[model samples]
Target: MHQCAKEEKVRVIACGAIAREIIAICKANRLGHIDLQCLPAIWHAYPEKITPGVENAIAEARAEGIERIFVGYADCGTGGLLDALCAREGVQRIEGPHCYSFFAGNAAFAENDDDVTSFFLTDFLARQFAAFVIEPLGLDRHPQLKPMYFGNYRKLVYLSQLEDENLKRKAKEAADYLGLEYEYRFTGYGDLTSALTRL
Candidate 1:
């Protein structure tokens, strides 16, 4: 088992997608006792890279003498590998299948079975839709591929972490581009706040 650090402060190794929200939460709560580190947001599309990346970050932090570390990722499509790594390393992570569940509050998200046909986008994703979703999915290169990719998705749900009208507009446009209905949910960091407070 890993030992706790003598220092009272803790480090949070986060997914780059939620880095801004994590920082905002820390600043708003005056959680100077915690530090934050993040891997690339693009890794959201590449689940295979997440485990090693998080492991490397943890090792780096431990080498810096920070024995207390909290992973900011949920299972995040790692097929429980991320959880397994955390278990072996003796570090705790936010509880949920992914960021969407955590941001919407795990219990509420679990109860919302109507969202199974939904495609989700957070603020960061809304901003990077073109780069991350459109281009990467080849929708920009081949418009005919849109239906193939989004055929099963009936709606695009924009889970807003902050009240940004521009991002909402962008999310709506993304839904339009994907030929899906649009929805907006203002979650405001939901359980992320509580998780950080626990640190």
Candidate 2:
């Protein structure tokens, strides 16, 4: 996952999907104290890999003499396994059940009922729609499978970390592809800013 120089920087074991956003936030805030390490973003399709991957990253960080570590992942479909790993290792992860929740602000996202049947996309998801979703889900090869996979999903909500027209268009195209309604929400970093700044 990561290799460090046994310095004073705080290591961040994070989800690769938000790696760009993390770099953006750190740069904007001048958070030069952090050392960001991300696992493969494709793991979103294989959640069983998250906890074990994070555990290994943690062990590696510790071995590199990095005591101060921050996990930039949410629960991320690992159920409570990530939380258990955090507790057992005495480390802290970003708040919220997943990126959608945290990027929308955890408390506010919890109270929103629209998400019940909404398929979500962040900037990364929008940009990597083909590799992350269409190709991985086999929708590119078997178009008929789209309906079966997204039968219950009513809409696609794109949570934006940066307001970009290209990403918005891509997101809308994804929604159209899936035969779902399109919704765009500009949520810049949300609680992720506060979480990292506090460290």
Expressed as tens digits, the lDDT of each residue in 29-103 for candidate 1 is 778778788899899999999999999999999999989999999999999999999999999999999999999
Please, what are the lDDT tens digits per residue for candidate 2 over residues 92-146?
A: 9999999999999999899998799999999999999999999989989998998
TM-scores for all predictions: 0.95, 0.95
Best by TM-score: 2
Q: Determine which window of 10 residues in candidate 2 has minimal summed lDDT.
A: 1-10
After superposition on all CA atoms, what RMSD does each candidate show versus the true structure?
3.6, 2.0
In model 1, where do residues sit more than 4 Å from their true spots? 1-7
- Cα lDDT computed for each candidate against the true fold: 0.90, 0.92
Residue pairs in collision within model 2:
none
Q: Predict model 1's lDDT versus the native.
A: 0.90
